[model samples]
Target chain A: MLDTILSFFKKKESSKDVAKERLKLVLIHDRSNVSPQFLEMVKGEIIKVIQNYMEIDEESLDIQLTKTNSEDGERMVPALVANIPIKGMKNAGR
Target chain B: MGEVIVITSGKGGVGKTTTTANLGTGLAVQGKKVVLIDTDIGLRNLDVVMGLENRIVYDLVDVIEGTCRLKQALIKDKRYEGLHLLPAPQTRDKNAVTPEQMLKLCDELKEEFDYILIDCPAGIEQGFKNAIAGADKAFVITTPEVSAVRDADRIIGLLEAHEIRKPRLIVNRVRADMVKRGDMMSIEDIIDILAIDLIGVVPDDENIIISTNRGEPAVIDGKSMAGQAYRNITNRLMGQDVPIMDLNVSEGLLSKMKKLLGFKTA
Candidate 1:
């Protein structure tokens, strides 16, 4: 079932879709009043700090940044959200 | 109720004043009382393009400074009875007028005209602030070029930041032939990028230069296809559900002309 659904959307995105995605990213950055370089620097610092005290596999970790509709356009308030895959926390508990 | 609309583009030479003049003329031609105010102090051109420079006994500065009455400064167009102009002070700096003063002046003008069109200066500074201080809406003008669109995007961002919504777009200098040849951006591409409602699309015509020289807008002449587009926009603004001019009409003309020229519409 998943294979059928995945194949259905495996088709390439239209040129219009590509252009809209680019515009959305640029507008998000512009509206948030934050530079892409600044976002990168922030993501790097937050990931580095999160890895220090976590019992998770760094290689299988993913950290993504996004904008949420807030009171202001975008306050640039960083959210330390991550999905870290724990390799063997149960085995370590023993 | 009088609606104040500002024609603004953050970048220079994107034809803000020209769009303001033409739209004002279009609205006036439709029998709506329209007054175009040039807010590009010390470098005014609405007066020049509208051909009312010599008739400007007073300007925005004069009204703000209490030197003259607002009606005294307004030069009514003899050609179009409903059209009026409030020229910018060519000799005074932009600092001569404050945003508050502009707001009050617009409030005064609102009582008189159906539409008060403000021609904003380029750049996002005090001049821009003054231009938008009292505007009920914004008509952003941009050419179908990367630089112009980018500046327009920036201007739209500023508007969003300032909580200015419902800002419509006017894509000027659009050459359909160039767009077909992939040399110019299409209307669809622009609207997709800007994410704004397309209000008007003015084609690049040599008659614009001639009309500017004559102080007559191209929209007055039915021969100019671009003029028809402006007239359509004016009708749309006046609470009328008029269809788009170029997209439907010009395409038919193009296919017909192409067939005549031994070219097929594929």
Candidate 2:
């Protein structure tokens, strides 16, 4: 019910919003030179490797490329961070 | 010594050459010796824009290749005596002149001229590289659009990598009506994302088109809004403090109501 009310008040996306969103997505790929297919392949391999060790929640997996400052805060660096939920260990409860 | 400033934009048709012609003319009109260099090579248009296409006996490649002396190659502007143009060769491509050659040419010109403005070609290629080789400063121009601003950001990053610590920004062809209607991005929105110091903002004026067609820079026209903006930018370039021109549309009751409803108005 609250979601519907919030959605009703939400402003419509204008042409400027669409353009800004498109630029945001394209610039990330352009700067990193990474493709969606490559990211999918990497995700599949990572999930396969993790599943061999323990049960995992694949649906909850998230991966993203973001910009972060270097150690000395001198330059911007592209970082790939991931989060995956673990269901259970393969062998024992421990 | 003169300062070599490169007018560059990664995207095409964003008014790099137009800005170069105006700023060069503006400086010359201010009693400064200025030379405009068209580094676009095969796709040269500055000659036509400056209305000196008929007087081109020698081009940039000729001066660099020793085919003609620099003085013989420069085409003098009829309107402004202090303004000259070194046009690009229409036959050869970007590879005809190297970065080293450009640096040497700029070094020789610096001894005589007060300003050396290089009009860079679009895209981050060899032409762009050679254009900036001799520039002590860079002015990155962009329209207040998503694609143009994105390209401008990329160019800024590339300029930083090339050790150009400070690059100014010029937002051109801005629309006041659209901004008042909450349809177009405002200057503040653009500056927030680009994170560069704003040098100038030119309103969308139709006189610019007429002046371009006439091969006369609009900066000399006192009635043109864009011309006024260029004059302010030129003053800023000369270390003078000139306030940016106001581009705000008249605030009617409807606009005031729209603003009260959380609508963003430029």
Candidate 3:
């Protein structure tokens, strides 16, 4: 698959490419350094935290540990972009 | 008393071995007594890359296990008089040697060699810890791709956590043509993503592949552009201001004169 992609555009499989590809995998694994089961457990715990207060809007709720790679700013942070539909009146929606 | 440099990348086959072999050779060629240690343990291959595979009888495990002394296991490079090799045992796994043992080995080596270059194993496993245990500084090798850049960033995080500051980036195997065609990520892109100081950039050369097979590092031949790049990196290590080669720009008369006259690249 990587070879296909390498051939697709242009092959920049140089040292820079080596570093770039390696960093991607490293970042993902470095976050937990554990198995997928552990990640699932963490995800479930996070969902439970949100579920304790109110019902989750499954479709709109997203809890992800995202990595942002900017020129000057690169970070690994958990993003909780969720929308919980409250069971209150229309005026109660802030 | 010189420095111990660990050349590492969390991803495998990203030229950690190649960088170690080349940089070690370059340092030795510049008259520095250097020892290149392969800390990969069972999957030992740095010796093969350095053309010292045939001479490895007492491996790293042997040195650690008290089967042989450190000096006895050190394989003197036949090509470069000042260069030495401490081959990893192909028989034993990483557990056979602990990071403390590796640290002791490097500390013992410090008195003899000017530079101790470690070819670190891939992944942040016990092997990686063993590789970086006694290093004074590190060079994180990476290629220009999303995955490699991400891995480099993670490795940088690990290094920082361990307090190994200023791990310079060595961008290897860069293809100038694709970069020019806007197909591949530019050096600027990789550096921007990693946000690290660039130490050197090596162009992807068929000669490196050929040299690996030949067991003769092309860095020995200054004619090869990749060799020149490695030499320049080593010179930079030695506090020389050797310029990075212009792999993309044509070495036309003007550029050649400018490079010769030590022009600061744009």
> What number of clashing residue pairs does each candidate have, in the order they appear?
0, 0, 32
Expressed as tens digits, the lDDT of each residue in B1-266 for candidate 2 is 99999999899999999999999999999999999999999999998888888899999999999999999999989899899999999999899989999999999999999999999999999999999999999999999788899899889888887887779889899998886676777676676577777788889899999998999999999999999999988988898766666787544632432333231111
Predicted structure 1: lDDT:
0.78
Better of 1 and 3 by DockQ: 3
Using Cα atoms with residue i matched to residue i, what is each candidate's TM-score against the true structure? Answer: 0.74, 0.79, 0.74
DockQ of each: 0.10, 0.28, 0.19
User: Per-residue error at A30 for model 3, in Å?
Assistant: 7.0
Q: Total backbone clashes of model 3?
A: 32
DockQ of 1: 0.10
User: What lDDT tens digits, residue by residue, belong to model 3 across residues B1-266?
Assistant: 86899999888888999989998999988899999999998898998888877887898888889999888999999789899998988878788888888888888889888999999999998998999999999999998766676678778878887889978888888887877655567666676567777778899888899889989887897678788888888888887766666876334522543333342431
lDDT of every model, 2 decimals: 0.78, 0.85, 0.78
Among all windows of ten consecutive residues in candidate 1 chain B, which has the lowest summed lDDT? B257-266
The regions of model 3 sitting more than 4 angstroms off are A1-78, A82-94, B249-266
Each prediction's RMSD over C-alphas, in Å, is: 10.1, 8.8, 8.4
